[model samples]
Target: MNQKKTIILDLTGCKYFDELHERIRIAFDFPKGYGKNWDAFWDFMRTECDAEMVEIVGESTMPKEFLPQLELMHTVLSDLKIENAKYGWNFDYKIIS
Candidate 1:
């Protein structure tokens, strides 16, 4: 049987963008020089990772000040899904509050 890979990123105590980025880089094992920015994030999600699904949890506990960043993450993932479909890659991303 083939099993799809699932990666979970728990962002429970992340209060800042940098902290969130660092945690994601470590959790996802991003490359040594992974750029910690939205653009780089999209690029990595689109090209580097090979997961069938990615789950981001604890968003409700994130600082209100980081809402924009959270929203951007969601948007980027949505865009990536659309782009992936066009290229015949099955990818899915989810945010959990």
Candidate 2:
């Protein structure tokens, strides 16, 4: 499945970037608790945001949004439902065929 793309919100003077980063980091790592669980992504956004600040992006399969919660690293990531199927790093290099 394709990963969900994110919308960048330029918080030029926002002072909550670090807190937001921690929140998102916890969520992404422990999706069930602090991460973007399928059941709770929209729920949290709806409750925690105003009507204009949050808008759902991406396809139905991977819906993302612009969260004005305050952070640069707290962007969207693809959801893999399986608990054990964690996302890992990628290493790519050019190889002429």
Candidate 3:
């Protein structure tokens, strides 16, 4: 079976980590009261997410402070892919300008 690719991460006008998390929650249709943190992100992605590709927009324009979190997100997604290897599950992202 083939799943349609989805771009759930776009930081075009995002200027803060909280804003980014809200975008993520909205994009992924996360339920209310969702924890807007890395652990929450990892748990959701590992157990419930089905999006194949999460395109990250505005890489160049993101605030300097956002870079650290962005890198952490990349790491989390990468780790998610690895941990789900047993199920042959895959996740990927692309940074767009």
Candidate 4:
């Protein structure tokens, strides 16, 4: 079996939702024309991303206004986990302090 790969994304430098999305795209090595939006993120993660685990770091440094977006991102990841399980694709994610 192939070894699992873990990916960590630090949000310390992100001041806006766009930056957060950009970080995700870069970390996942998404396509060059990746759409920087929540829907697009969900689509790519469910269909293309191969990371066994994804960790979110340095979130406290991000802007307060981005709280909603942050919450929704977690929601997306959680939902993806369920779908992955059904397909026999193991995956997990977490936010770290």
Clash count for candidate 4 is 0
TM-scores of all candidate predictions against the true structure: 0.92, 0.22, 0.86, 0.92
Q: Sort all candidates by lDDT, best to worst.
A: 4, 1, 3, 2
Residue pairs in candidate 2 whose N, alpha carbon or C atoms collide under 3 angstroms: 27-34, 27-35
User: Which of candidates 2 and 3 is the stronger one according to TM-score?
Assistant: 3
Tens digits of per-residue lDDT for model 4 on 1-97? 9778998988876997778888988989999789999899999997889898998998888878888998889999999999999989889998895
**Candidate 3 backbone collisions, by pair:** none
Residue-wise lDDT of candidate 1 within 6-94, one digit each (tens)? 88989997887888988888877898788999898888887788888889989899889988888888898889889889989888988
Which candidate number would show the highest lDDT if scored against the true structure? 4
Candidate closer to the true structure by TM-score (higher is better), 1 or 2:
1
Q: What are the Cα lDDT values of the candidates?
A: 0.86, 0.31, 0.79, 0.88
Model 1 residue pairs with clashes = none
C-alpha-based local distance difference test score of model 4: 0.88
| Cα distance off (Å), candidate 3, residue 50 | 0.9
- Candidate 3: where are CA atoms >4 Å away? 1-3
Candidate 1: count the clashes: 0
